[model samples]
Structure formats: structure tokens, C-alpha cells
Target: MIKGMGLSLIDSLDTMLIMNLTNYYKHARDYLAETLSWDRDIIVSVFETNIRCVGGLLAAYDMTQDEFFLKSAVDLGDRLLNAFQTPTGLPRTTVNLKTGAATNPSWTQQSSLLAEIGTLQIEFSYLSYASKQPRFAQKAMAVYDHLLTLMPEDKLLPIFINPDDGKPKGTDLVSVGALGDSYFEYLFKYWLITKKASRWGKEYFETVESILNTLAFKIVDQDEEMWYIAERQNKNINHKFDHLACFFGGLLALDAQHAPTEQMRERHMEIGKGIGAFCRKMYTMNPTRLPCDFVNIVGNTISNPIAAGKGWLMRPEAVETWFILYRLTNDTKYQEWGWDYFEAIEKYTKKEYGYTGLRDVTDSQKLEPDDVQQSYFLAETLKYLFLLFSPKDTIPLDKFVFNTEAHPLSFFEAQ
Candidate 1:
């Protein structure tokens, strides 16, 4: 057919990047070895690699007629599915790239109480879509089941949950407030993908609806900003919510899709806008030209009196506004803002040890890398920036890659 033409020279080059990027599979097994010292590299390879695989495989499947690329993506999907298995049903945050064993543990791994929970959904969904396998969906469903039972007493998800024991770990309602939307995003997304209309999804939707309704009316200050009320026991933390609270934009978009009222999506867009506006105000009000992490402090207020302010580099989520603005407007301003934010970070923060020195003002210009450089930062940061800066006509990332697990999940789609 004349409709299909020969590939351009650029296609070949892009293919090479995909191929070479993926060629590290053999080394993935030894990810924990000292040789691959950059935690980001190992995390990117074993865990975060899913984003690229999904991107490459999905892109190749849709645009190119390359069977090898598609099959390779499918094979990677299968390997990831197998790697994610755990007796407790909760997957580890970090795993030994080579040995297929659990390595480091972040509380976020279990409770995810946020979008981090969607890791399996993305992997399996891509596998299912790319390879047409039902097994991937089935594997992902198991994770949903496991995560559901781990919810805290108030129905509010915690910042962290213990992976091994299936219990709460640290910082009850602190880090990932997006855990709320994250759970709903995958639940509803799975429903859409499989057309199964899961009852679990129905229940989750109902609960999330109630929470959103409550958050809509509740205000911490006159600023008219709504935050997920952090619960210590029976009381509210009343701290100002950070936009990067967890999967805020993407999950909100997913929820907006299923909202019974059109106002829901509009409200979400408004929230996204508000975050940017607030950032602008903060820059002006502080007179420091530095972005504020969050408003209000609660609980014990550890190293920093500001509950959310670990520092400029510590806030992986400050970019939430940037991501949301771009998502809402599809304009370069947001992307430019994102780039500006990164530049400020690069200017004020230095990469040390492995982290971007969570505390910029406190580092005394000395480097004390992050205890955990956090794959989440790169996974979210690069994907958002890439989509923002990249050509919108050819590729617009409504969903970005988060992580890659080692297992053969192509079977999920096939089934």
C-alpha cells in the first residue's frame, strides 16, 4: 500500500538508542554489585526500566513495523512480571538487578497509598497491550488486592507501609498524599483496559469520591487550597499540602475521567493552576527567589520545622505544578517553568553522594548526597520534562514510564 512508506533515517537512529539502552539486560542481574554503583543506574535498569520499555515497545508497535522491537518489549514485560512476585503480594521498592532478590526498602514500596502502587498496572497494561496477554493484567490485579488490605484504619493511606510484614512503617500521612489518587488511577484504568468493572474498583471509587468531596470543602487557610488531611490517630495534621504529594497530576487526570460531574476535571485543572500560582507567590513573598516546599508543619517536625521542606533538592514533588500546568495547557510555559525549576535546583543544589542534597540552604555548599537518590525523582522528572519539551504531534505522554521489573509478563496480555 502506498499509505505505508519506508522508514526515515531518524527512525533507525532512534531504534539504535532503544536497542542499546535495552542491551543492558545481562548486566541487570548484577545490579546490586559494586560495579554498578550508581543506584540510579541499577534502579533505572531493573525497576525504573519499565518506563523506557513501555515507551520503546509501545512506540515501535505503533509507529514502526519492527517485529523484533515489539517482541523484545514483550519479553521484557514477561521478565518484569516474574520479578515482581512476592509472597506477601507487595513488591519491593528496590531489587537486586542480577540475583532477582529484594535489596533496599523504602516505606513507599508497600503502602504506596499513592500512585507508586500503579507500577504493576503500567507494566502489565503495556505488556497486555503490546503482546495481547491476559496474564499481565492478572498479575497486576494481585497487587491491587494486596495493597487494598493494607489500608489504614481511617481509610486514608499512609506515607509508608512495611513490605515484608504488611504493616505501617514510618510517617503515617506525610510523604505521598497522592497515594489516594494513585490507587484510584490504576483501579479505574484497569477497569477501562480489561472492561472487567471490578467490584474492588467500584468500592475504591466510592471511597475516593467521598474523600474528594470532603477535601473540596475543607480549607486549611484563607488561600482556598485543599489538602489531604494527614491523620496521626484521630486528629488532622492540618499542614499545607505539597503538589508533589504523590501522582497528583496523572492520578487526578484519571479520576477526572471517571468523575460523575464535569466540574471534577475542571476542579482538578484549577488545583493544578493554583499550585503554580502559589509557587509564584511564594517566590515573591519569600524574597529569596527560592521555591517553598510546603506550608505548615505538623507531627514531630524532625530535622526541618517545615514538615515537607527537606530542602530544594529534597522536594522531588515541587515540579508537580510544572507538570500539571503543562498537562492543563499543553504550552511551553510550563515546560519552560520546569526547566527553570531544574536550573534553580542545579544552581542552588549540588549532586553529592548520590542525591541532589535534599537540603540546599543547609548543605553549606558541601555535598551530602541523598541517603537514597530515589528512582522516583528521575522516573517522574525526566518523563515530564521530555514530554513537555518533545514534539507534541508525534508523542504526547498521558502516562509516563515509572519502573521496570524483571519477569515475563507478556503472558498477561496473551491470556
Candidate 2:
């Protein structure tokens, strides 16, 4: 359960600052200063630690210029660095905070998820800059550099990779969901965070072109066309879709503004709208007005919920995309869609103490709460919702880049 990691508290630090909750922010800061400790021997997820804890600390430090935040972030970043001690310098899934030992989770079979390793670039790069430690940047870049060597001309990255030899593992499967979303996410964001001075933009665009050409497709449903990104296993395409991928809509919209050409910009924005609409439709299609975690698209309908697909974990991806699309296009429809989704969650999932996830989004009458409130519900979902209705200038896209956890780390102009 990642005990003592301060998941929700640390993850929501930037949101408190952005929302102008001064007392809450001060209390959180004091908690981090007075209570947070990394000396425990607990095993923590490297990806989650970086995106939530380190990213949140860095975002707070950047906004407030407070040494305590930076000190906490650097301390956490140093411990996380041990996860990259693999032969390929790709961070494993979990690390021991006390002993500096790292290992892949048993289920991963000594291989790391592509997103887990690839998502570290932004957090560590900023940490390096903030702490004046080049090793942090170099260690994170090593993973990206090694990945560049692995990419074929097609640029569709495998979801699983063995850290021992830095080779693609398992079937040649590629997805922009669970195992691979933030890898591509960080590629584009690192370029923005660095003020476009790095090779990240070129790499990001190349990979995105491959994603559009190979993975993205339109599924027809009852005479309606919806755009969704599919997964590829070798030569075969799988019609499985994840709500986690709903983030792509916002990401595409964000990328469109910075595209190198007008055509690219228009193309990305058009597709972004399609994907955003597709995600919004899921809420209406379900009886409870909430979408499932994942579903299989069978021609004209979504059927066969797999694993935990029927559950709604209060995910933020769809709303995050809605917020970005609304901001970028000034479209009131996006805001309308987001409001509807928020209202549904409030009606069904809200409890006396705190909100929880739904056990089954498809059943209107039996909307049982899972009793677990995810940290992202605060770090990303609610934060995105708060920013959605706020003035666009509150956290301008030009000045700040968000980590996957929704921490707004500001842009640093090139020297």
C-alpha cells in the first residue's frame, strides 16, 4: 500500500497552491518539513514516487522558491536515483528507500514497463536543475537515450522491456494505455519544460506520427464515428480501449499549439477533438453517467469488461483532456461535458467523509462505492476540474508544464 509515502498529501501540494488554499498549503508544507521521512525500508513504486512525491515537491518549490520544498524533493530524488542501478540504467518498478536496493516487481518478471522508465525525464531533469546536480539529469537521460537506440523506424515502442539487456520483452505489443502512456507524454512535455531547446520535440513528433499512422483509428457505433487509439500486438490490432488513454485528447491539443507546421497543428487539434468527444460520450453511454476503466470495442458496441474494467477509479484522464481542450479551443462544450461528468461523480460517489470509486459504472441502481479514494482524484481529477472553470491565465500553458501527476512545474528559459 506504499505506506508512509504521503501519496495524497504530497501529490496535492501544487493543487493547494494553485487553488489559493493558503492554510492548507502551509499545513502540508509543515507536515512535509516536520513529519515526512524517506529513511524507512518500505518498497515504493519508482514511477509513482517520482511523479507524485518528487514532482509535487518540485512544483511547490518552483512556485514558492521555498528551500524546504526543494530540500524535501532533492532528498526524495536522491533515494529514487537508486532505482536506476540496473545494468541498462533503466529504473526498476520498485526500490527500497532505506537500503537503496531496487528490483522489478515480481509480476513484471525482471522487466520494467515502458512508461515506468520513460516517464522519469521531466521530474529528474527539473530536479537536477533545481539541485545543481547533473547526475540526476544524466541518469534520467540515459534511459531515454537507451530507448532511442531501441526504437525501430516505425517508432512504436514495446510496452515491456528487460532492464538487464535493454531489450524488448514479451510479445511485440504496443499500447498508449497503462504500460506506455506517460513515456510518450513525457517526450512532448520535456521539450516544453526545456523551452524547446532539446531534441525532445523532434523525438516526440516522430513518435506521434507513428502512433497516428499505426495505432489510432475510428470505430463506428450505430452510425456514429468515434476516434480511439488501439493496441497493436505485432501485425494484429486489438480493439481494446482504456479510459486512461482519454488523456491523449488533451495531450494532442497541447502538442498542436507547438507543432512545427500549420498542417500538423490542425491535424492534431482535429484528432484531439474527436478523441475528447469519444471520451465524453462514454459517460452518457453508461447508465450511471460514469465510464468504466477499460472496455473492448466490438464493432458497434463496447462489451466484455476485462479484469477491473467495470470499476471507475475516479480517474482524471478524460476530465484532464476536457480541461485542456476547453482552454485551447475556448469551446464551452468541453466545459459543459466536464461539468456533467463532475456532477455524476458527486451524485453517486460522494460519501460523508470523502469520495470513493464506483464498483460498477454500468449499473445505475447498484452504484456501489469501492471505498478507496485514489490520490489522483485530488492530484489530477479535482485539480483539473478546479482549473477548468478558472481563468485560463491561472496557470498558462506557455509558462508551466504538468507532470503526469498534474504537478505544475514551471518552464525555465534556456541559458
Candidate 3:
């Protein structure tokens, strides 16, 4: 384990404040002030550090007017700036906190995943504004500027790109899943976070059009038609759907609100609902009511399903979309689906200390635990669940935009 910072604790601070766990919030704040240190020599995932620690701290600082949170965020942001010291301004995958040394992960020998390199914009842009450090935003925007030159005419960027030369690695595969989900996500969010004053808004609209024309498809299952987005390899389409891609539904709905025309808004919402419904169906296909990490869909048939080995990772993307859809449309059906999903999670995965993942979501009689509860479980999953039930005024969508990690940074500075 790379023990660089108090990731879980820092990530959950805003949640504690939102949930009004006053005692817990105070204790977490004190722990950060009294115990947490950023001087340790540990290698950390640059993406994770930015989204959870930087995003969470900034959200808390905005909410509570706490200088400690801002100070902590700035300190961490200063250290993470080391990762962007590359020829192309695309950051390495990992960096040493104390030594200012950086490198890509082993899986990618000389390239960085699209999502990792592109997802830092929202966090860094906010950081620059909050700290008056324009360098953070400049570095973040430099990556986007370089990517614009390399983005294909179809707008389907390859999943991997060389960090040093700013070129797409020779890969035919394109996905909005593990390696590339949030790159597309941040395009729209960055625009909204700037209150639609940034040029990225135009890019967001164009990319969505490209996605609809190229990557989206519908299939009939059990006499019910549903939409699912697919990835592409050269000219061939892969019907394998990723649980992570479930976030597309909420994204489409959110993006729809900012659509230039009412007709475009209606069309986007219609497709968003279709995608959300199909994702909910994935959970119901199994006995335990949890989705697999990935599934292959062939024509109208799902085949060679593999949930036994990898299992569920307590993903929140589907639920996150449902919450956003409910808020946007005032639809009770989305809330109902979220409640049903939560009940299944409570019955099957709840543990004494915390919830665990499932090794076999298909087996209700013997549900095996995967023993890995990701940080997003607390940061995104539970936060979305809570907001799913709370009134719209809790964290108004117009006033805030969430990072991929679900940390809500306000559109206006803290008053």
C-alpha cells in the first residue's frame, strides 16, 4: 500500500459535513490538522490524489470556510505539480510525494491512459482559482490543448497516448470505460464549473454528437429494447459493456440541460433514460441484484458472462446517473430503482465494519465477499445514495458541479 496521504479520511470529510455528522466531521478535521503530513516519501496515483484529496479538500474548504482544508489542498497540489513536468505537459501516472520524482505505471511502458491524463482539469482549474496559482490551471489546460491537435476527426480518441511526444499510441481500441471514461466526462464538467464561460463547452457538445453518431447502439433483450454504448476497435464494434460506463446516463442528462436547443435537450434526455434503464437491468439479471464488472452482449444474447473471478467492485456509476436523472426530471421511477438497488446491497453486501463487494452476484444462496471496499464506496456511492433521497435543495445542481469522485465544488466561491 502506498501510504502517501490520508486518502479515505480526506475524501470523506466533505461527506461528513454534508451528512451533518458534526462530531465525525470535527474529528476528521482535527486529524488532518494534527496528524496528516505530506512530507512522506511515498508514490501515489496522480489521478486518485487529485480527484479525492484535492477535490474533497476544496469542496470542504468552500463549504466551511476552513483555511486548514485550503492549505492542505494547496500543499498537496504543489507536490502533484511535479507529475506534469514532461515535454508534452501530460502527467505521469504516478509520482513520489516528497522527492518530486514521477513516472508512468508498469502496465503502460511509455504512455498514459487517456482518462488519467485528461481528468485533472477540473481539480487543477479549481485549485488555480482558489490558490491564485495560475500555473496549475495552465498546466492542466496545456494537456487539453495538446490533445486537441491529436483528437481524430471522428472524436474517438484512442485509449492510450504517449506522454512525451503528445501522440496517440498505435491502438485501434476506443472506450468510455476504464481507460477513457472521465476524459469525456471532464470535458463537459469543466465547462459547467466555469459557469459556461470556458471554450470546453463547445468541445463537449461536438464530442457528444460524435458519440451518438459513432459509438451508441440499441439492442432488444427479453422483448424489451434498451440502449447501451459500445467501444470500437478499428472498424469493428465490441458489444462488451462496462459497469464503469454506466455514468454516461447522468452525463447525458446533465449535458442535456446545457444543450443549445430544446429539441436537442429532449433527444439527449430520451437516450439517457434508455441507457439508465438498461444498466438497471444488468443488476436484475443476476440473483443478488448487483452488476458484474463487465459483460459481453452478442446480438440480443449475453454470453460467457464472467462475474465469478473479478466480481463487483461496489461501483456507483449506475446509481449516480439515477440520482442525477431523478433530480433533473422529478421522476419517481429513478428514486424507486435506486432504493431497490440499495436494499439489495444492504441484504447481500453489508458487513459489521463496512460493506464488502461480491465475488458471485449470481448466487443468492451463498454470496461470497470480495473483501475490497473501494474509497469511492464512501466518496461517491453513499453520497449519491444519500442525495438520491434528500430534497433537491441539499446540494443544488445549478450551484455545484461534481468531480468524477463526486466531490461537489460550488460554482460560486464560498461566501
Candidate 4:
């Protein structure tokens, strides 16, 4: 919550900081400093630390012009670099700060999730830019460069990669969801942050086109008019969509703004709107007005509302897309949908201590609350909701590109 709150303060400093939230920033800063000082050798997960801690500190520094945040970020960045000591430039998933020992999870078979290795570019590249250290950026880009050579015939990467050989590990499971979402997210964001100077932007545009062509499906039933992106496994399409995948609509909408031609822009918008509409249905069709973890789309219609998991773990991807669509279209209906979602969260998930996840969002009579409340509930979920309702000028779309965690980083400042 501290990391996210710090970023939130940066996001709306003019309003939030003025609203007696300055103390919150001070508290977060002091806590981070104290923790780092006391636990100088604390081990951390690379993915979690990059998004929440490093991303938070950099954003706080940007907002406050405080050297403290910058210094902390640099310290954390140097510690994280130990994970990249692998032969293939694909960092291990975990790093020990004290011992400088890094290793992948024991469960995986000499492989790592594609999203884990592929999603570090934005944070690491920005760290290099901010600290004037090219090695951080180079290490991150090396992972991308190696992965590019391993793209499949369809140009869609598998969800897992063999870090030892820098090759794709799975052929059956290819997706823009779960283990693959932010890989594509960073491609566009990295391109945008670099002011289109990087080839990653062109790569991002091409990859989106490939995904739309190969993975996307249109469902045109009487009750459902939605576009679902499916996963390809074992030479067959798995007609499944997850709430996590819903972020694609927002990504598509954002990428449309940078389309090269009028025709391309219109096409991107059309696809984005189709997917956005489908994502909204994932919420409205559920009994609790919150989406399940997965829904199966069979042949031209949604087969079941909750075909897979019924839990809603306070995820932000669906609402995050809603925020983007609303920002792009100025459609009040998106706002109305978001309000409905918020009400559902309050009704089904709220607890006295703090909001918890729902064990079954489809069960209204006995709404079971899971014990966990993810930090993203504050970081991405509430932040996106706040941005959705705030003045459009609060964080102008043209001025900022939000990180995967919904932390807005200024494009102008990044350069």
C-alpha cells in the first residue's frame, strides 16, 4: 500500500498532496528508508520489487524532486541486477540481496514465465536513463533481443521460455494473457516513452496486428456481441478468456492513438471498441457484477458465465481497460459500468479490517471472502478507478503512459 500510495501521490500531486496527503508520502519515505537500512541484505522477488518498489521510488522522485527516492531506486536497481547474471541475459525470478545469489523457482523446469523475463524493460530502461548507467538498460534490452530471435512462425511468443538457451519452452500455450500480458504492454510503452525512437514501437504494432489476425475471435450471439482473444495450445485454439486478458482492450485503444495512418487508426479503434464491449460484458453478466477469473467462449457465443474460477481477487485489468476506453471515447456509459463494478466490490468483497477477495463472486447469498487483499487493490484497482472519475486533464493521455502496474510515468520526464 505504501508503494502504491506513493505513486498515487505522484499521479495527482496537485490535488492529493494538497488534500492532507503529504504526510502519507513522508511516512512512506521514512518507512522505505528504515527498511532498506535495517535489512540491507533482504532478498526480493525481481518482478514484485521492480513494479512496486523501484517503480514507486522513481515516481516519487519524479514528483518530489527528492534525491532520497532516487538514491533508494538506484540501490534497489543495483541489487536487482544480480538476477541478470544468467548466461542468456534472462534474469532469474528471485534474487538474494545479501548473498548476491539469484535463482529461478524450483517448480519450473529450467524455464521462466515469458512475462517475468520480458516485462522488465520499462523499469530497467528508465532506471538507466535516470541514473545515467547504460548497463541497466542494456541488460533489459538483451532479454528482448534474444526473445525476438525465438518468435514462432505466427510471431506470437509462447508463455514460457527456456532461460538457459533463450528459446521458447512451450508450443501448446501461447497467449496475450496471464504469463504473457505485460510483455506486449511494455513493447508499446517502451516505444512511447522513448518518443518512437526505439524499434520496440514498430515491433509492438506488428505484434498487435499478428495477435488480432491469429488469436482474436468474434462472438455474435443475440445476448453477446463480443470479441474474445483465445489461447493457442497444442495446435488447437482454446476458446477461453480471462479477466487478466481484458487489459488488451485498453492497450489496443492506447496504441490506436499512435497509429500511423487514418485507416490504421480506424481499424485499431474498431477492434479496441469490440474488445472493450466484450470486457464490459464480463462484469455485467456476472451475478455479482464482478467477473470470474475465466470464461469459455464456445463457437460463436459465451458458453458459460463462470466456466472456470469464480473468485474475484480484486483484480484491476477489466476496470483498467474501462478507464482507458472512457478516456479515449468520453463515453459516460463506461463510467456508469465502472460505478456498478465499484458497488459490487463494496457489496460483496468489503470487510471490517480491509477488503478481501471473493471466493465466489457468482454466489450472492453466501459471498465468501478470501483472506488475502492484494496490494494491487490499492495500486492499480483503486488508482484506475480514481483516474477514471477524475478530470480528464488530471493525467492527460497524451502526456503520460501508465506502467503495467497503473503507475503513470511522465513521457516528457522519461526522456
Candidate that scores best on lDDT: 2
lDDT of 4 by residue, 342-368 (tens): 898888888898788987777678777
lDDT of 3 by residue, 134-188 (tens): 8888888889999899878888788888888888776768888778899999999
Regions of model 2 farther than 4 Å from truth: 220-225, 304-307, 413-415
Candidate 4 has a TM-score of 0.91
Model 2 local distance difference test score: 0.87
Error of 4 at 289 (Å): 0.8
Candidate ranking (TM-score, best to worst): 2, 3, 4, 1
Where does candidate 4 stray beyond 4 Å? 1-20, 37-43, 221-224, 303-308, 412-415
- The better-scoring model by TM-score among 2 and 4 is 2
The per-prediction CA RMSD against the true structure, in angstroms, equals 9.3, 1.6, 2.0, 3.1
User: How much is 11 displaced in model 2, in angstroms?
Assistant: 0.8
Which is superior by lDDT, 1 or 2? 2
Q: What is the lDDT of residue 300 in candidate 2?
A: 61
Instruction: Tell me the TM-score of each prediction against the true structure.
Output: 0.60, 0.97, 0.96, 0.91
Q: What C-alpha lDDT does candidate 1 achieve relative to the native structure?
A: 0.45
